[model samples]
Target: MKEKLFRWVVKHRKPIIAFYAVAALVCLFLRQFVGVNYDITSYLPDEAASTVALNTMGDEFEGDIPNCRVMVPNVSIAQALKYKDKIKKVDGVEEVLWLDDAADIDQPLATQDKDTVETYYKKNNALFTVTVNSEKEIEATDAIRDIVGDEGAITGSAMSNALATTSTEQQISIITVAVIAIIFVILVITTTSWAEPILVLLGLGVSVFINWGTNLIFGEISFVTNSAGSILQVAIALDFSVFLLHRFNEERGRHGSVAEDMVQSCCLSSVAVFSSGCTVCIGFIALAAMQFKIGPDLGLALAKGIAISLVSVFTFVPSMFVQFDGFVQKSQHRPFVPPLGKFARLVLKVCIPAAVVILAVVYPARVASTSSDITYYYGTSHIFGSDTRLGQDMDKVKEVFGNSDTYVVLVPRGEVSEEQALSNELKALPEVKSIQSYVDVASPYIPTGMAEKDTLDLVEGEHHSRLVLTVTAPYEGPSTFKLVKKIRCIADKHYPGKAMLAGEGVSTTDLKDTITVDKGKVDLIAVVAVFAVLLLATKSLSLPIILVLVIETSIWINFAAPLYTGMHEFFLAYLIVSSIQLGVAVDYGILIADRYREDRVTMHKREALLETMEACTIPVLTSGSVLLISGFLIHAISSHGVLKQIGWFLGVGVSISLVAVLFALPGFLYVLDGLIGKTTLKAHFLPKDAQDPVSDTTEASAADGSAQ
Candidate 1:
């Protein structure tokens, strides 16, 4: 069956070549219409618990959705009141609520005692809350910026959207350009012909379009699906093309006819490429097992994309290959010689003593270092910009609001009827900065002698119930946690089954809590899925374990570097670490193992290892170098530190995986060969050659005549 398929490809090469040329042109034009989505909310599952809760809250809030807080500095109560109408007149602004308006008019500042008046109304500074009705229709970021204009600064969770989107787009663009450039350079170096790289790129472009067109046919394309998988496709397709072309050249060098050599090349290279693609597809499919919404989507998209790339390699790549085979053969390119191969040989020569030294020194150093901080995921500029925004906003909020901290407590609807008890308990909490409830708002102007409980009559109505307590902490760190916990305890004691906490701080805490709870399950799923793919691909129990070890080591080393660099962040670590490890490590493992298996058939275990190293090293190193250049280029373009961190970690991880494959895999293979029976190991490494039960001299004569 394989021989027949090979013969067909050879016989119809010209027609196939023409078909591919037409297809490539069609695909090229179709790709321009594809759009990319950058919304973070897109990553969330439609039915996820947090998403559900958020949606429920949104529905309840109705027309009163919360807007991002805005702060202005060096402004007084009078000044704020004076500009209140001006602020309200802003195009997007609905209404501005300030402390001056919130305060009771009956107890005017001049009537209150000095200390009481001072506490109630500061002379110079005032805080205001702006409510925009279009919160749901318009992005909070766009609305906030429109209102604030150039007059004042705004900061909060809303700002994160703009910053994150801009940074992510920039990172993607920079990485894509850099990766392409690096791949082009590497191709030129290896093939020694500028035209070959251009041809490979042309093939890649066609593959990308086909991949897109297929996805479009399926339905709406996912942004993550498109961006993340496109690069992976390009990398895999280019490598496959290089492999096929190289094999074609080798067959020709053996004095075989062009048609025969082309058939042989396709048969040999396609098997390896298809096998590798299957493994990658399995690895990605395994991600579907993850509980997170984005995880499954990422897995499915990547798996599909890889499968498409393999098909493209067989069809589109072959067609292009047939057209360009003559030029490629004439190029006389030198194979890549990895710089690290020589270093590996040097280490092997002094293995015993060097191993002892590494164990003694490096092992201890590894213990002292820890996994990288999540902040490092953002890279440098992102962190600095975020910090600047936080600091500037905090300073302004402090000046205007008299306190930078705020908290919101939710009392159950039933518990709100017992508002007096809840308010008293909430106000008594040690961390309470200030307390406000419907009770404060309902009471008419009261004299100074009025009892405190009587002042709470404002919220006594049955339909309108509940108190909101705002707390200010002495310090930013542990105090916020302590305050929140104390308030929760108070709510539990007074409202027992009903009250809960919900606000900016509470929401942030909830997100963190959810991640912590789900982290282990997600991690386990990812690890198992990746390992299973590796196991099936190598068809060896030990190789899968070694691959996992190499991946883990790369991740650890990549993450730890961020800690030393002091750019680590929790969000960055959670998002990028596993993704980077999964993306680059699997590719490296497949390429190395494929080469090893191909070499094992013709040589002894030791010689096979050496030859595999020589054959695979160039592609592996070139791929790694391209990945690194792309990552660094992203880091350079991104002002966001998290992106820089991702770039750095991903680049480093790829480089380390490359090194591990070259050195660690060979060493481990050597040990495995020593332990496993030589015959089994050799058989495992050998490629599956086509079986020829029948020979036809007539066909051979025709093939030779056609070649001439």
Candidate 2:
């Protein structure tokens, strides 16, 4: 099958190259038709209580939860009422609720109930819960800004999401350009030909468009997927093209014709690249096992990207190389990396002590990776530039309101007495600062017809009553988890199976719980999956363990570096970086190991190790530097903290992996070659004076081919 693919690629190079070029352009155009969804609640599993309650609230209340909160400082009761009226008049605003919505604003504040007034009016500030039409939130928000002017501040999920969409659209192109420039610089310095890097990037760049165009099948993707997916696809896929081109260059010198050289190189490099790509695919696919849909969304897109990249390298890259054969030959120069036999020995000498020191710090790294101060995890600061008016508005809102969690509870419509009792219980809890229920506005003793219809419907649905509980417990802390558990207990005791809880806090709590377990499962699955691939690729029992250990150690060091800085790391970053770094770094080991296996047949063990390092270091280091630069660029340029942290971890991981692969891997292989020989399915390594059986068999086959 490999030989056939090679033959066909060489035979039909022109058409294949032209088809991919056109297909890439078509995909680029088609991708603009695809949509992106930034609503986090919408991504939750249907069976989750928060998801169900959110859906039910939207159904019963004529819209979803309050999408934006408008803060009006130093406003009179009359002025606040007038502001609410104007907001309601906005085209896409479905509803606006403030102190006046529940009480008569003309009445003295002293006469009104304290709970109702305090809910909307705190100190000299008044707040409005604005429910905007989902499809027109941006337009509605713009209208609100126009009416409120600079004094009024608005912050909420919808506003943040709108900002994120704009921010991502603005920055993705910049990120692409930066990554390409950095990659080009690295390739130019390391490779013999200047055109090689550009050609490789062309294949990867086209593959990114094709991968994104296919997302149209899914209808939409998350904000994270939209932002990070294309860049990551390019970074990972570039390796295959680089590997193939390097092999082709080497083989071209040995073969009589360019076509024959490409065919032989493609057949050998395909098996290598296919195995490595599969390992990465398996690592990404493990993310789908997470119950959290965010993992699955990112995982599926990246996994598909890896598949596209593999196909592109096998088809698109070879065809382009064939077309540019003469130019490529003309463009060749001496590689920048001179032979480093002494450097390889120096690396081996320091390898053991360095490994031992890294092992000592692994525990500290694990602890730092796990510890996070999560109160600010979902802040709106990242939505807009801090220097902008919109950013200032968000800061003002946060300052005035402080960070508080709101939980919406639903229970079967029971005797008004039971609801009144439940509301009292919730209000009495230490963490609960306030509770708004139907009982707040009207007493159960009064007839339903006598109560204001709008006031009655505000907290009462057809079959269920709603209670909005404001809690002081910080998110993702033990207090928050305990508060949630206590509320669930109270609900279960009061209403049995009819009670459900949903809110930002509830959703985040669920996220925390899911990822705590998900981290371990994702790591284990990534290692085992990649291990299986290595085992098949090497046909050696000992090689897989050595390779995995080398990469995992680098990952731990990457994670540990964050502990020195007091900034809290996002929990998802650890799980994702661990799996991804392992998947990515293993390719380096595979490349070196493959070279070592070939070199050992002709050279002594230590001499073979040096030759392997000298041969493999440039490509391995170039790939690492590209990853490192890309990661740091993301860290430096992104407004969102999670993305920045992810980028930092990625950069650190690649740096450490490069060091390990170049230094420790060779040292370990030098010591363990005899054991590797004993366990291998196809042992090829021999001492300096030993005869080679595999080479003899290959020579005999070539002689037979010549005779035929």
Candidate 3:
């Protein structure tokens, strides 16, 4: 069956090439339909406090939690009121609150309360808490910016999301070009034929483009998925092509014709290709199980991209290689890379010592990794540097307003007396800077009957009354999370199960809780799935255990590094890197072990180990270098917080994984060859008849404590 398929593929090489060409055009055209969602808060589970509160607010009230705040500095009361009205009139601006709503702006400035007045208008600046529809954020913010030109500064959750989406999308375009250029240079230095690199890129690039087009099925993906998915596809796609090229070139002279060699290569490469790809897919597929929607969003996209790249490599790559045979053949140069035989010997000599050192430190690394300081907030304020406009605007607001956020507490409208009592209790709390409700404002200043219809409507909904609490806490952190819990406790005490809270603090708490559950679940799922794949491929019960152990050690150290450095990693990055590094980086170990297994059939242990290292070293180093550089490059180039953390983790992870696979795995294999030989199916760990000759140097080294 395999022979027939390969024969047909080569026979119809031109037609196969033409099919991908047309598919590429169709995929490119389909790219416009894939939408991007930027709001991380929207990914919260339905049962979370913020999500429930948000839903109830949507049904019961015309307004939502404030998402944007625009400050027009140096404006008179009348001018500020005029500016507020203009902003309110803008399309998509649902509700705008200025000083007039809280304290009568018409009153004399001397008689009006100073703290109340200064909350909205202070230091000749008027700050407006604008509730804008998330879908219309860009349109509304742009129009509001037009209203308050040079003197206005805008920052809030809405504006932060808009900036995050726009900037990340832009950075992806720039980084894709840089990544491609660097990958091409790496391939050139490693590959004997220059055209092979071009073919590999074209083959893989088309797959990534098609992966984007395929996202139309998802309707919309998170901006995080769209930002990171394509680059990862490009990087991982090379793994499949690298193994195929190696198999093809290695089998070139033994076969009668190029087509025969290509077919033989495909057959020989199948186990490695599927094993590696399956492990990577398992890693991504585990993410789809996360309670956080971004997990599914990113997981499905990345898993799909990996599957598509695998198919493209096996089918499209073979066709391209055959069709462009003369071009690829003539472009061949001497491979600039060489097998470091001396280095392999040295690594083998210290294998036992290095393994001992790794074992001694790995436990400490695992403990520290679990204790890493993780931040859950996705706000661009924390992500972007203070020099950025978003960060500056946030700092400016905190400096003036004393670092506060507004949470809308919803409860059944019982009576003005009860509501007022609830409001007063809430206002008395140290965290509660102020409170705004119909009971708080209407009774003291304007009678309910005399209040303007719009102002009254903002506070009173059909089934619920809204108390907007101004709390002295930043957007998200331990303090804000604690504040949210305390406020929820108070609201529940007054109106249990009837009251709901909506704000960034509540949302961040939900995000933190949701991801905390997924971290363990994802780890378990990935390990089990990848272990099954490794077990089936190697047909050895013990091989999978050893490989997972070595790779997992690398992961422990990767996450633990953040603790030593005092960098509070984004919480999602740990789960992401753990799965990615375990599944993806384990391929290096797989290659080494598989080669060692094959070579042991004909040669003694040390001879086979040397040959395996020499054959496996170039591809592993090339692919590992590509992945590591791309990781650090993304970390360096991307301004997005999540991407930066993910990039840094990936860079560090791949480097550690490389060291383990190259140095540590060989040691384990040498020491445990008897176990592997006894356990692996068909038993290829030793030469036939159990007596293979070793070189004098290798024999002398073995006598010095190589075998137990």
Candidate 4:
């Protein structure tokens, strides 16, 4: 079946190339329909208390989240009120809540509680909560900016997401170009042919487009997925093409023509590439099982991308190679990277001691990785610096508000007495800076009927009453999470089974809990799935265990370095890097181990090991370096701290994996060869011979000639 398929592909090479070109165009056209969602809160599970509260509040009170906040410094209540009225007239504005919205501005200021009044109207500044549909936030924010002019500040989730989306959209083309250029240069240096690098990129570049275009099927993807997915697809696509090219070149010496060599190489290369691709897909597929919607959003996209790249490599890349046969051969040169025989020998000598040191320190690294800072998840760090309007607005609000945390508490309405009691208890808490509620604005002493209907409706909904609790603590500290719990306790005491908390503090707490549960599941699924693939491919229990250990050690070392430096990593990044590194980097071990097994059938253990390293190291290094550089370049170029952190860790992880695959795996295999040969099903290895060098040197020289 494999021979027939390869023969058919070779016979229809031109048509196959044309077919992919058309498919790529169709995918490109579909790209416009791929929507992007920037809201992190949307990633939360629907059953979460915060999510329930938000939906209920939206339905019952028509009080959508005040995702955009406007801060006007040194402005009087009268002027701020006028400004609010003007903002309300904007096209997308739904509701504008200010001090006057809660109480009649016509009434005397002396009648209101000082803290309640100051919450919105301080001595020299006023804050307005402008509620707009998330879809129209950019329009509404632009209109608000025009109204507020240079003095006022605008900062919130709505604006930050809008800014991030806009910034990423503007920079993606440049980043993609930069990545392609970098990979092209690396391929040129490592590969023997200049034309091979271009063909390699062309083949992979089309695959990236197909992956992106197919996102139309998903409707919308998370902001992070769209940002990172393209680069990853490009890198992986290039790796697959490189694998095919290397195999094709090896077959050239024995075959009569380029077309014949490619046809013969297709089946073997497809098996290897497909197996490795499955491991990568498994790694990402585990993410789709996460309760967090972002996991599925990113996981499905990446997994699909890898699948598409694999198909394109098998079908599209081979066609291109045959079409450009003459140019590829004419452009051949000595590979810039030389053999690593001496380095491999030195690394093998220290393998046992290095493995011991790694075992000793891995636990500390695991423990340290668990200590992550959740604060960065809530705030926005602008990529364009503070000189931009978004950055300046963020700074202005932070300066006026200091570091404060706010919570939106929803409780059953119509229990005026219990509600008043809950409000009083919240006010008395040392952590609570202030509280804005119906009881605070319109006292219980005043009959509900006598109060203005509009004013009453603002705080008291049909089924739920809203209390905006301002706390002195910042969003990330222990004090802030503690304060959130304290407020929940008070709500349960006063209105048990009816109260729910929804805000940054509540959302962050949910994220921490949700991710904690999902992390274990993802890890287990990835390990089991990849293990099964390796077991099936190699038919050896011992081989899978040894390979997994080598790759996992690299992951431990990658995360451990951050802990050693006392750097605070984003919690989600730690989980993501762990599974991805294990799945993707394990391929290097598979490549070497597979070759070693093949060579061992004819040669002794030491000779086979040396020959395998000589053949596999450059290809592994080329692919690994591409992956590493792509990540670090993102770190160096992107301004967002979240993206930068993710890039830095991925780059570091891939680099560590390369070291383990090249140095540590060979050492382990050498020492464990006897056990492996005995346990591995259908294993065959030649007897040890003192004259193994003759065959090794001859094979190495022939391999060198072919590369040049």
Residue 547 in candidate 2, Cα distance off native in Å: 1.2
Residue-wise C-alpha lDDT for candidate 3, range 1-708, written one tens digit per residue: 877888888888888889888888899899998888988888887887789889988997888898888898888988998999999999999989878878876679779877667778888889998998988888888898799885688888888877787788888788888889988998899889989889989998889888888899999998878887888878876888888888788998698988888888888778788789888988999999998888888888899999998888778999999888889999989968776788778877987777776788789888888873633444434776676677777777777776767799998874677678788889778888667898876664456678768767888888888999777777778888798888888888888778888997778878888888988899889999999999999999989998988888889989888777878678767777787788777778888888888888877788888888877887888788888888898888888778888899989999999888888889888888888999999965565466665565667787887665
Query: Higher lDDT: candidate 1 or 3?
Result: 3
**Candidate 4 lDDT tens digits, 208-314:** 77887989889999888889888877776566777778778778867787777888888767656777888888888899999888888888898899899888777
- Candidate 3 regions with alpha-carbon error over 4 angstroms: 109-114, 146-151, 372-381, 444-451, 687-708
**Candidate 2 structure, TM-score to reference:** 0.92
User: Judged by TM-score, which candidate is best?
Assistant: 3
TM-score of each: 0.76, 0.92, 0.94, 0.91
Is 1 or 4 the stronger prediction by TM-score?
4
Candidate 4 residue pairs in clash (backbone atoms < 3 Å): none
Name every residue pair that clashes in candidate 2.
none
Q: What is the lDDT of residue 2 in candidate 3?
A: 77
Off by over 4 Å in 4: 102-114, 339-353, 371-395, 443-451, 689-708
Q: How far does residue 93 in candidate 1 sit from its true spot (Å)?
A: 5.0
* TM-score, candidate number 4: 0.91
lDDT of 3 at 220: 95
lDDT (Cα atoms) of all candidates against the true structure: 0.55, 0.77, 0.83, 0.78
Give the clash count for each candidate.
Answer: 25, 0, 0, 0
Model 4: lowest-lDDT 10 consecutive positions = 374-383
lDDT of 1 by residue, 229-309 (tens): 666567645656777665665576453567676677788776556655665566566556544444566567666767766
